[model samples]
Target: MDLEGLKLETERLLLRPVRGDDFESWAAFCADPETMHFLGGVQPRAIAWRAFLSTVGAWHVQGFSFFSVFERATGDWVGRVGPWQPEGWPGTEVGYSLARHAWGKGYATEAAATCIDWAVDTLGWTDIIQTIDPANTGSQAVARRLGASLRGPGRLPPPYENQPTQIWGQTREQWQVNRLRLRR
Candidate 1:
């Protein structure tokens, strides 16, 4: 809730609210072939930017939303990572997407861990879910690494003709347990 005032920092990323000016880079990332692999391999720049705005606008209305992710070291827009609760979903779900070049570097894991920590520790979120395209094994691996247990396949009907996704999640209790184990 109140996404505007929120900011989270991880080892290599800073999670901040997406702004109007970020549209260009965000669009480029969303439109890139490599980066859009899981998003049906890219869309028109206008379409991507409009979608991004809808997401941000929803945050304003819903009180919780995704944050634009930036690589702290290089200060570049790496993409977006945050909590997503679409119309049909059961609970607040964690979602993340990054530029293609940022892959294989552990940034997704680090930023995601930080977001999950904040979700449970500060935001009082209970069940966190993530639906990763079955073909995006890299994202599925990141989900697993973040301690989300696989919950099986999910389908997004119509307009979104993507491959089936594998759902993964962690309850607040599970997140706490994992945190404690890490501390130990």
Candidate 2:
């Protein structure tokens, strides 16, 4: 994909690949228990460092990963949101995980919609999915707001194989239709 130095912008957010400087904020976000409740519990700085490294590696190796999101107005590191699909993943996914402080502002929906457009148009993906725990009503609302439908239950690869998840999805055509709403 040659996404070198790729950066995408939303109305209130600036999205880019994770940088070396982002490790600290990313570690803090990963360490937040409340924020990590649905994300396999909070991790220590050591583990967060590994995850941060993996995130950076994915961009270079897989040519894509969730972009580190920042608030345009404040430049605060808000979260990560973008295309992600590792081995055994159900399908091409435009996933999201924002810090607690960044919740309830429609950033997930806005950032996801932007990524969905890129995934469909640039990646040439036919479909997209988001694996969310059933209890995560916030994410469900965001999926609905972005016009995806609940496809059914799903499971991830080992390590997270046992985690309960529901697959929400839509197609490229569906996103084009949904994009109309965003434009309106």
Candidate 3:
């Protein structure tokens, strides 16, 4: 797929591939302790750059990656949301990570929902999963809002083997049923 001009736009957001300019906000987001609480830990600037490269690299290697999100109204970088699955991932997953200031605005649910549709339709994904930390009620709520159910406990690949997570997901058929329930 030629992703050169590809982008997904919601009523309030603009979703597109990660860009070099997005790194500054992306780094700041990762550097913040609160925002990175459930997303590993606060990464230093150098580590954040490598992490940024990984997402950008995923697009080339996997042909798809999380979209860097920005509020259409103000053009501010909110965070990222979309497809993600590493070598030992339990299943195809659609995840969200947003800035602290972007919280409480329903952006997570919105972006994840959009990503789910794209993944299933464009990527031919049969089922989608989200490995969420149990203690992160905020993300759990977002998952619930998207009509995903808590399937069971999930484990990540090495380096994060000890971190706990709950697998949440639904089949493509279920998503069709649930997607209708959402207010467009």
What TM-score fits each model?
0.90, 0.96, 0.98
Please tell me which predicted candidate would have the highest TM-score against the true structure: 3
- Model 3 vs truth, CA RMSD: 0.8
Every candidate's lDDT: 0.79, 0.91, 0.92
Task: Write model 2 residue lDDT over 83-165, tens digit each, in one string.
Answer: 99888898899999999999999999989999998888877999989999999999999999999999999989989999999
**Which 10 residues in a row give candidate 2 its minimum summed lDDT?**
1-10
Off by over 4 Å in 3: none
Q: Model 1 reaches what TM-score against the true structure?
A: 0.90
**Residue 22, model 3: Cα distance from true site in angstroms:** 0.5
Residue pairs clashing in model 3 are none
Tens-place lDDT per residue, model 1, 54-93, is 7878678775667888889999988788777767664677
> Which residue pairs overlap in candidate 1's backbone?
none
Who is ahead in lDDT, 1 or 3? Answer: 3
How do all the candidates rank in terms of TM-score, highest first?
A: 3, 2, 1
Better of 1 and 2 by TM-score: 2
Return the lDDT, model 3, position 40. 94
**Count of clashing residue pairs in every prediction:** 0, 0, 0
